[model samples]
Target chain A: MSEHTVRAYDRDLEALDRKISEMGGIAEKMLSDAMDALSTFDVALAQQVVATDQRLDVLQREIEEAAILTIARRQPLAVDLRECIAAIRISGDLERVGDLAKNIARRATELVDEARTLRAIIGLKSMHDLAALQLKEVLDAYAQRDAERARAVWLNDADLDALEDSVFRDLLTFMMEDPRNISFCTHLLFCSKNLERIGDHTTNIAETVVYLASGAPMPTDRPKTRSFGQAEEKP
Target chain B: MSEHTVRAYDRDLEALDRKISEMGGIAEKMLSDAMDALSTFDVALAQQVVATDQRLDVLQREIEEAAILTIARRQPLAVDLRECIAAIRISGDLERVGDLAKNIARRATELVDEARTLRAIIGLKSMHDLAALQLKEVLDAYAQRDAERARAVWLNDADLDALEDSVFRDLLTFMMEDPRNISFCTHLLFCSKNLERIGDHTTNIAETVVYLASGAPMPTDRPKTRSFGQAEEKP
Candidate 1:
């Protein structure tokens, strides 16, 4: 390839990476705000989060279209092919992250009647914070093509799983103690699962970053503590 | 283009489509077996469902690799390119379906303790049947390239959601009526959500099929009945 063609391809990749960052930035904010809405019962903010997810969806489709066109045009090979695939994969997962945020937001109104369970809310918030950070770090790693940093995030998923288990147990206790809290606690359980899933999507991106950096798929399953009890590998 | 080259490309796509069918077959069986295990508390069958997921994962990776290579070698344009991308997208969702099956299988043992709520079991079973049928129709739609059939399954998702909501309510009632059923009902709830997710993945394949047939993205949101209440679209 000539220098100019290589430079043009580089520019295309850079533009793609920038689109991912724009998505990551908005999704990160959605996660935080969804948690805040959950905490404060801010239904209006929750509504905003729901609305914002549509933008992410549009962005994902655009990214996928661009990726297909790029592969058709550039005929990327090996590492370059992997990078295009990675962009598509990341866009798909990021789009899901937006949906997860919307799931959390929907629960905000339901939490209004459960003021009694406010004490139990702290656990979910902390888990949300962890997930948000993971999302941010993984996207940054992708932007920098930083495999080691991505590996760190990949390994750190165990912490999010652990936190999820704790939250699950805590919420279960709340519901078991009183029948009235059953609905609210169940909603929290769903929301916690959403957060854990968002964390998993981040790890998916981390795996892609690692693959893009090293030109080999990650050789092992994602690190986890196993209490979720499904024996399938992450994609 | 020479007829010979066009025939070769068609052969490649046919082979890829066959692999997806093989995957669809196994995943559909896994869903049925997982639900059977749940109904009978047959942990061994459940274990088999979990183990079989590994095959689906391997198939997905193989499909993805082949799609990338084909794009690089053939430089397929327009509809041809969309077909390759569609293969990748379908494989991703099919892999998740396997995970959902394994998730259901894991809940089989937990369902053993709630014989009294066996009446509640029927609710979940019907919902499972609905989702399984949707999975079958969607895969067949992909095989036949029937966008209309795919659209029917996509629109039918709302029915599954409403069924899930009913099951959720019933199971919660069981747990609230007797504290001893908390563990069992809770597990059932998770299993129900897994089934609902399996339905969602089918719709995803449906979307891909629509895109594949039209060579244009489906320009509207999937149809749904509103009571599940989350404003954002399916993942």
Candidate 2:
């Protein structure tokens, strides 16, 4: 490839990366708003989340189409091809992150009239904050070609898993302590799950970033076990 | 493209499709066994489920590599390129479905000695059956290039969502009625979530198939409202 062609292709790839990060920014806001809606019982914010998911859906398709065109027109070989493929995959995962946020918002809408306490909301915010941070860091790593930064995001995923376990146990305790809490507790449980899944998808994006920087695929079988032993110790 | 090369490319694409379907078949079985482990509280079956997941991961990489090679060498355009790209995306979704099944089995291992009655097991079984069926039908549709069949699979996803909702409500009721059931109930809830996610992934594959056959993207923004309604109903 000529130097000019190479430069052009690089620009295109960078543009795709920027679009993905933009989508990530939107997803992060959706997750934060979902949690905020849960905490404040803001049904309007939840509805906003539901409505804005369509934009994410459209952006996912646009990113995908752009990636496909880049591959076909540029015919990037080996590492470049892999990077393009990873970008496409990351876009899909990020879109799902948005969907999970929307689901959390939906649960918040249901809980608006019934939620009496903010304990579950606090746990959810903890998970959401960590997940969104990981997502942003990983996307930045991809843009900067920083594999070490991506690896750090991968390592932090265990912290997210631990928080999810804590939230699960706390919700279970509340449901068992009072049958009247069942309805609200179940909604909180689903919200906690949505948040945890967002973390998982963020970890997936981090893994993809690592793969793009280093041509080796990450090990899929290594189980990162972080036991939340203090489940019963907290109120 | 020369006619001979075009024919060769078509044959290569056909072979890739066969491999993806074979991978899908194994993933479907893995999901089925995971459900069996959940319903029977069978640790041995759960271990088997975990063991089989490795094969799915291997097959996913193999199919992906093959798709990449075909695209690079043949430079297929338009519909042919779309089909190859769709194969890559479908394989990724299938691999994630396998991961979710393994997660369900992992949760099953924790529930083996729990004292909860088997009533909730039926709901879980129903969900597993519906998701597996949807996966099987979607793979079959992709193999046959039947957009009508693929659209049918898309419509049936609501059944899996309903089953997931029933499972969630049943487990919530169990947790509320007995404090000792909290751990098992939480595990069951995760299992149900995993199965529902697998269903969603299968729906994604079906949508891709529709896109490939019709040259138009499937509508992914129509929120399936019944999922929340089912969750709101009484246990």
Compare the candidates by DockQ and give the number of the best one. Answer: 1
Per-candidate iRMSD = 3.3, 8.1
**Worst 10-residue stretch by lDDT in candidate 1 chain B?**
B226-235
Superposed model 2: Cα runs more than 4 Å off:
A226-235, B227-235
Q: lDDT tens digits, residues B3-39, model 1?
A: 8878888888888888899899999999999999988
Could you report the Cα RMSD, in angstroms, for every candidate shown? 2.0, 3.8
**Highest-scoring model, lDDT:** 1
Per-residue CA lDDT of model 1 for A1-235, tens digit only, reads 6788788889888888888889998899999999999988999999999889889988898888787777877887788878889999999999999998998998886567653588678899889989988988998898889999999999998898888888887888888898888878888888888898898899998989999999878865665676643222342
lDDT of 2 by residue, B51-117 (tens): 8878887888787778777877788888998888888889888988988888887777777666776
- Which model scores highest in TM-score? 1
Q: Check candidate 1 and list the clashing pairs.
A: none
